[model samples]
Target chain A: MTGSAAAALQVEGLWKSFGPLDVLQGIDLEVAEHEVIALIGASGSGKSTLLRCINLLETIDEGRIFIEGEEITAKGVNVDRIRRRVGIVFQSFNLFPHMRVIDNVTLGPRKVLKRPASDAEADAMRLLERFGLAEKAGQLPDRLSGGQQQRVAIVRALAMQPDLLLLDEVTSALDPELVAEVLNVIRELAAGGMTMLIATHEMGFARDIANRVCFLDAGRILEQGPPAQIFAEPREARTRQFLTRIIEAGRL
Target chain B: MTAQGGPDATSRGGPASLPGSRAQRRRDERTSALRSTLVAFLSTFVVFGVLVYIVVNSPGWPAVQASFFAPDIFWSSLPGIVAAFLVNIQLFLISEVLILALALVLAVARSSTAPVLFPVRLMATVYVDIFRALPGVLVIYILGFGIPGLNLPGVPTDPFLYAIVALTLIYSAYVSEVYRAGIASIHPSQTAAARSLGLSQPQALRYVVLPQAIRRVVPPLLNDFIGLQKDTVLVSYIGVVEIFRQSQIVEAGTFNFTPYLATALVFLVVTIPLARFTDWLVARQARRGGGASGAASQVASALGRSRGGQAAP
Candidate 1:
């Protein structure tokens, strides 16, 4: 908001590598307020790494990142403060297995946001209720079904009241029948105008929720456009080939 | 263990099978189990009986029995040995508490990834290496004698103090390795999930990593405590007059080695139960599939609903 011309999130010329392999090469992206961007790619196509680097969970080899127009990658920037505005739900549903569902949801707000326990719990309960996970609040994550666990993870991210949320294949690990339940939670968030950048293999879900879809191939966004354009008439051969594979696999 | 599962699986799979065959199978299993039990008992009895017979028939048997198995000397020495064991208990108790606190600090220091904490990590690594490389008694001797030998002002010359300090230093090195392994066993994603939620490294460790790590290492930690308990006798070398020293005193006074046997009995009484307890905990942890927190929290959740309330509309 401070920089009127800036998007809600921005990355310019992002480059990241792991020892001998480059994961992201010369990447640029901008996510406007309340816009949903779905990143579609193969397994090693850098989607999760991109999300991690943006959250500062992984160090970037060369890049500049901004959240709400503040240069997060600037020297001496407080990565914690930057991460506070960005919430991420992982594929594995990394809820603290040791804590109860309510505690898992409330931990961030209570510890990092400095909210009182009662205040944090109250908000967490509301989020759980909204996600239809209220009854399971007292249980540990392992007791819940995969769909339920992923939903709880989403609620945990939402508890921070983040300005932006990144979901890295959030439903990839769930049973096929359970995927819809988690996708529905994302649908509701999208309907409510929550800004999200999702990395997904869920082609149908991605097309349904994303305003814009970007197909990444070999660590680069080979093509990106409105969902209609990208899904129906991708201009790139690699995007077409990927979509054909998904269709042949009956995933789309 | 797998054989136990096999019968149940077969029984469930073919309910229409002949009742005669089923009865035959059960009888066969019972007979096999009985046969194995009898063989185990007979083998152990024969092995130990021959060993005892050799010892009792040896040329030095009478002298050894008079010196080592004198009933009167054992009974007379029993009271003193039991009393001196109290000192060992006290040393172990005090040293265990200090070791827990100090080892946790070392583990956290060595687990740190921050550039600012590099020196702390280095020092912890060095401390663990140095203490673990040297023999425990050497540490006890050097500290118990060397430090007091300095005769520095206000320094307590008590060997008890040095005994405890040396025990803590040596045991903490090993215990910290257990803690470090526990910390490392936790998958990296757990920390990432916490850090992604905006928690700082220290906060993530305190709330997420350490709680689970400490719980996972409880059995190992208690195993080390048992070792520390037995090692308390090593302080006898430093003139602390604990169990071993007391037994030595009784032996010299009475000219019999039976007091040494009595000392051994006292340690067996104290430490065997503890060793068994550690084994039970390890087995229980394995049965629960390494999620020790799951069973306790599940019980807690079932007992009370502290977080339970009406869901918001």
Candidate 2:
């Protein structure tokens, strides 16, 4: 169990780059338990890059990432172990197309955790049933709707029982009608006290559900606070400009 | 092939039904079919007829027939040629299994990005390049003569195994490229999705990449297998008495080349079944529609169509 004392995730002066492009420039943040932090920014603001650094999917150029009081970004850390604790759901809903829904959900638990097939399947069925995907357990992911596939992707991450969940534009790829279903699932997960760091463009959903909102700009968290202070009261002019553009675009 | 009263016939005949009932149509169809059959028979005869005439009229025809086409020598050579083919089959089967397993390893090694596996990657690259460049006959000569000439302890002296080693080495290099192409064809996103779930790279490959890769390459792999089966005759260059070598021995004796024809016919007999099997694999892959996603997408589209019809306003 993750203890109450430590933040679920802590990033200190994290920097990352790809060749000539500097993606993340010294990002520092700490997320408390059961916290839902909404990372709001325009396209190419390095929101996804920051989340990927936390999961160790992208090698950082500098600084360290700690999960549950232990720095996992240090050299020679067990990658699979760290990954097990930090589950990620991608924007594309990259389910193994060849596998059945139940197998997709059970794969991490069975192969990584070495759980018995019966136990894993039983647990997967419970997750699927809870997510209204029990009927799709035998079906391939290609057969599911975009919204249903995103929901299954969430269930897959939850099946690992991760200490922290990294959601990278999870609903950005869905249709307008489908976005509601995926957002509903995220809302339920938030209500269930899942610690999540979400990169999203849905300003309304972020305002409605996020415990804290952090506006990322050019690889930096320029502003962060409770949604009330951040949205209603001004902090930085840049953050205000972003909010005004979102308002003009009718996204907020 | 056209239907009765088809557009072309009806348009040209102009009120064909005026003179003919359905019974007359049937009779006309039968006559046209018989005429086409006779034309096919005569065309086949004419093609072979010219070649036979040229050959039989040649000034050296009697001597050529005595030395090359002697029917008695062909009959006598059948027993020996058939016996030697059993050896070729044995070599082909054993080497095929070894080459398939070995080539998969080489392919994976070549694809490895692990820093620690740099040496293995280099070795696999070098092996494939050298062996692929080297001729099959040269490979057999070196392994058959060279390794044994070293007189190393525990090295095989049997020509049979030496041939297997040479053939496996050469073919695995070629086959590894087929495997590499298959593996690389798989999208990187599949591996990323798998590794993101805590499966190690190798585990991801075994569970995700390989199943799809191997299935996708079954048709190509069968092609390489057939090539290997034919190349089993090259083992004779190292003094193994396989079918070709057996034919040469029979030809040297009795001063008749008909034994060569018998050997060639026997090879056709061996390869026809394998060729048919490759065709079946190709047909099955086609029917399955490309690969794994193909079948699933077909099912998905069918589901889409049925549901779309139901949901129509």
Candidate 3:
């Protein structure tokens, strides 16, 4: 579903603050169409906040976010329109617990897109199948495993056919064994040319899948470069210390 | 001391010589038997008390027996009974339908953060509080008699219509609280997920929040419906010829209270099934792990097992 050869998202001079706490300070990032970018940061470093801002889930204090050249931060812009083209998967899976997996996946398409039930069902089934959740089509979210639910959440977003996908620690809520399954589905999505911006702590998945990696700290982009440069040789002392602590904690 | 030592020695000699121990054992057994007998007797007494109360307090038992074969009184009261039944059903059904619709709107309006919604929120709060605080009798009386000067053109300000309107208004307030609680019980993440899927606020609420909220509120809603059913009797005060009112008229004419007993039986017959259905719904929700009781535990266990399995390898 790759469209024109243009940037899928461009976030420039994004400034956001929650009261006195500066969550994002003049951050800039870009992702080409079909490119995957990993945003890595410690908790409270504003990675998730940045992702939320891109999808307009969180209103930025200042800055402009554009998806497919449509400025999302413009006054009087229909946020719902922008959100339609940008899918987001939360860290908590956040599947509608009352709905069946199939229903959860097709809700947006059927309700927002106003598609027929049968057509939405078919598309939902296809997406569920892609995520290895076809068998769980009739199961409620709470009945599914955390990984299965997260994968279903992904399919739920994918059924919207977004131009850009924002993943805010999508696999963080899953069990370690299940995390790999969700990440594997995401890897497949990236390989299939889905444009993705992921905020994650899974360094191996980031290293393997991300075309570019950015390190964020205290609401600022500490560094941005290729994964090899960011992971293999760090130039900043803060980056080295952060990597050392993460490595010592056995999370890397 | 010698004698006591002798007895202790004898008791310690063998199990056969354990006099105090045997006696103590017999006493313990007798006490337990007495306790069991007392409990059984108390339960039987309670049951007998209820049956006796029914038999003694029930009016015109002999009259009912004498007229049992005649069917005259029963036949005479049939029309009133049928009318009351129909009105009761209409009142309940209309009130329930209106309550459900209004409750959902009120719930959404109350939950919204828009500045314009503030007045709506206040209005909903005031409506709920006022109706909930007022007795049903007062509400029916006010609607039936107090609103005399105001009448819609060509529409009769009849007691029946007044009763229906009053009941709908009162029940809608109570039902809205149920809806609000159900909607609030849902995790905020669900709304976030819907929004992230690009659903407009209305789309998300209609497709996502409302369905879940309605499902959770089903048992409570059923309870409210039963309450509404019973509250139909209050309309009798306004001369609507409901079951209670019909019974009163029959009693006045016949100088016999059999009709009142019959009315009570009718109420029992109608409300018992509704109560049982509510119970069944509650149990169904419980088994589905959707109710308040074990839902958290079940979710916790599921999450724990999944985490354990993942951690294993």
**Tens digits of per-residue lDDT for model 1 on B180-298?**
99899888899999999999999999998887787777778889988999999999988998999999999899889999999999999889999997787777666666564563343
For each candidate in turn, the TM-score is: 0.92, 0.81, 0.80
The digit string of per-residue lDDT tens for model 2 on B126-159 reads 9999999999999999999998999999987899
True contacts kept of each: 0.61, 0.41, 0.46
Q: Which stretches of candidate 3 lie over 4 Å from their true place?
A: A1-6, B1-83, B116-122, B148-153, B254-258, B291-313
User: 2 or 3: which has the higher lDDT?
Assistant: 2
Q: What is the lDDT of residue B255 in candidate 1?
A: 89
Q: Candidate 1 regions off by >4 Å?
A: A1-5, B1-20, B291-313
The DockQ values of the predictions, listed in order, are 0.56, 0.24, 0.22
lDDT (Cα atoms) of all candidates against the true structure: 0.89, 0.87, 0.81
Candidate 1: tens digits of C-alpha lDDT, residues A159-186: 9999999999999998999999999999
Off by over 4 Å in 2: A1-4, A175-177, A228-252, B1-80, B150-155, B269-292, B295-313
Q: Sort by TM-score, best first: what order?
A: 1, 2, 3
Compare candidates 1 and 2 on lDDT and give the better one. Answer: 1
Backbone clashes in model 1, listed as residue pairs: none
Best by DockQ: 1
